[model samples]
Target: MADSFLRPAVSTMRSGIAGALIAVLALAAAPTIASAQTAAPATKPAAKPAPATKPAPAEPAKDAAAPEDPLPWIKICSKDADKKNVCLVAKELRSQEGQLVASVALRDIEGDSKKVLLIAVPPVVLIQPGMRVQIDKGKQLEAKYTICFPNACYAEMEIADQAIAEMKKGKALVVTSLNIQQKPMAFPFLLSTFKKAAEGEGIDPNAGQQNQEQLQQELQKRAEEAAKKLQGGDAAKPADAPATPAPAPAPAEAPKP
Candidate 1:
C-alpha cells in the first residue's frame, strides 16, 4: 500500500516541475516577441556630405560721384635714389583767356647742383627770343630753344645761383615769350611763397593766385621799365661815353678822272 501511494505522489510532483519549466520558457519568448513588435527597425547609416564650401565676400559698392582730381596748379614728385628727397618742382601756366600756354619744371642739377629751368611752350608759339625769366624787373634769364615736340617747344636754361637767390627772395617772376605774331606776352608768375614751394616740394596754389588787374599793372610796369632801359641805353649818351668810330675816308680816287 505504501509503495503505491509513493509512486503516484512522485509522478504527480514530476508533472508539476515540467509545467513550471515550460511556463518560464514561454515567459522569456513572450518578452522577445513584444520587443520585436514594439522596437524601432534598424537602417543603414546616412552618408556624410562633402565639406560645405564658404561663400565669397560681397564687394564694396562703387561711388556715384566722379572722383576729384588733385590741384591743377602744381605737382611735386620725387625719384628713387640714394638721396631720398631729390624732387622736381613743376607748374602749369594758363592764359588770362583760359588757354593752356606753357609748363615749367625746375630741378637742382646733380653733381654741380646748379638749378635748371625747363620751360615748355605751346607748339604754335614762336621759338625766337627763346624764353626769358626775370624776377621783379630784374635781369632776364634767357635760354635758346633746344627742342620742339608735337605738343610743346622746350627750352632748358641753367639758372645762376644769384638768380635762384633772387627768385627765392623776390616777390614775383616775369616770364616773357613770343607769340605766333612775334609779340611779347609777359606772364607774371607770382612768387609769393616760392621759397616754401621749392623747399617743401610743393606750392600753395592759393598763394600764387593773382587778379587780372594786378597782372595788368605788373605787366605795364615791367614793360615801361624795359622800354625806359632800352631808350636810355640807345639815347642817353653819357658825356664820357666813347663816340662811335668814324668810317675811314674813302680812298683818294686816282687822278685818271
Candidate 2:
C-alpha cells in the first residue's frame, strides 16, 4: 500500500511541470505572430517613359503685288501770256542732290504741223559734239545745241510723224552725249507709257502746281528709305534735305536759230 501511493504523487508532479512549460512557450510566440499579421506590405517601383520630340517652325509668306513706278510720263497744256495754246508731253529726271539730270519734251503748237523735240542737259557736256537720240536699236537722229542758260543747255530737233510712230512702239529712248572728260554718257528714258501719255488729254495748267507738295513728300520719303537701306535700316540718323527744283522755262520761248 505505501509503494502504490508514492508512485501516484511523483506522476502528478511531472504532469504539472510539463503544463507550465507549454504555457510559457505560447506566451513568448504570441507578440511575433500578431506583429507579422498587422504589418504593411512592400510596394514595387514604377517604370520610366521616353521623352518627346519638338516640331520645326514655319516660313514667312511672300508679297504678290507689283512694285510701283517711281517716275511716270505726263502731259501738260497751258496758254502763254501771249494767249497761244502750248501742249507738251514731257519727262524729267533729277539726281538725289536735286540737280536735273536730263529733260525731254515733245512740244506741240496749235495750227502747226511741225512738232519739236526739245532736250535739256547739264552744262558740263560738250556742246560741239551735239546730241544723238535713238529709239531702241533703230536709226539715230542728230540734234544741235541751240542755247545755254545758267542751269541747262538746250537742244532741239524737228520730229516727223514717222519718228513719233516709231517712238510710240519703242521700249526706250536713248540719248547719248559726250561729257567734259570726253567719255560718252547715255541716258535711257522709258517709253512704256509714252504712247498713252501722247494720246491722252493734257492736264490743267494748275495741276503741276497743285501736286508739287505731294511730289516733294514722296521724294522725301524715298530719300529716307534709301538712306535707311544704306545704313542697314538704322533710323536714328537723319536723311539729307530734298533738292530744290530749278525755274522752268516759259512755254513761249522757242529754241533760237
Candidate 3:
C-alpha cells in the first residue's frame, strides 16, 4: 500500500513541472514576435499621373502669285567728269503728247555728305521768283534757279535729312513756280514709288545712254510735228497773198516839193 501512494505523488509533481516550463518559453517568444512586428517598414501610396496637353494649331498656307512690276522711278549711278562718283534718283513727268513736263531728281556726289534736290521745268518760268516745293500739304521749301538751257530751266537746293524723311512718308510732291505771266504753276510728282526707287540699284550706263537717246528722239519727233503743223497752217494761206505795202513813201514827194 505505501509503494502505490508514493508512486502516485511523484507522477503528479512531474506533470506540474513540465506544464510550468512550457508556459515560460511561450512568454519569452511573445516579446520577440512583438519587437519584430514593430521594426518592419510601412508601405507607401502610389503617385497620380499628370494631365494631357492639347496640340497647337497649324498656320494657313500662303497663296502663290506672279511678281508685280517694278516702280517707274529709277536710280542712276555714274562717274562725273571729275572722276568722282555720282548718283541720282530721278523721275520725269510727261504730258499726254509725250512732251516732258518736268523732272525731279535727288543728286548725290562722292565726298559730299549733303544731297541736292534738282528740279527741271520748261524754260517759260520766271527766274527771279524762284520755285517752291511742298510735300503732302507740308511746309513749303524754296529753291533758287541755278541755270537755264534752251529746253529746260534748273532749280536746286541743298536738301536736309528732315526733308528726305518727309518725302519718304509723303503721298505727293508738288513743285510750284511762277510762269512767264507771273502766275503760279504746280507740278505734282507721285511719291508712292519714291522710297523704293531711292533705295534700289541703278541701271547700266549703256541703258541710261539708250534712255537718253530715246528721249532725244521723242523730243525731236514732237518738234518736227509742231513745225509741220505751223508749216501746214502757213501753207493753207494763199501763196499769192499780197504783202501789206508800206504807206508808200507817202510824205517823200510832198517833202521834196
Residue 90 displacement (Å), model 1: 2.3
TM-score of each: 0.45, 0.60, 0.54
Q: Which one wins by TM-score: 1 or 2?
A: 2
For TM-score, candidate 2 versus 3, the one ahead is 2
lDDT of 1 by residue, 1-257 (tens): 00110011211112232233233223212112122223355455569856657656645544343222111224254444655434455554433222234456676534547677777655555776687888877888887888775645677888777886787777556666786788775544455455665766442333333332244355456557877899999987689978899999999988985
- What residue pairs are clashing in model 2? none
Whole-model Cα lDDT of every candidate shown, in order: 0.52, 0.63, 0.64
In candidate 3, how many Å is residue 207 off?
1.5
For residue 179, what is the lDDT in candidate 3?
79
- The candidates, ranked best first by TM-score, are 2, 3, 1
Evaluation by TM-score, superior candidate among 1 and 3: 3
Q: State, as a TM-score between 0 and 1, how close model 1 is to the true structure.
A: 0.45
- If the candidates were sorted by their lDDT against the true structure, best first, what order would they fall in? 3, 2, 1
Task: Give candidate 2 regions above 4 Å deviation.
Answer: 1-68, 81-83, 96-99, 232-257
In model 1, how large is the Cα lDDT of residue 78? 41
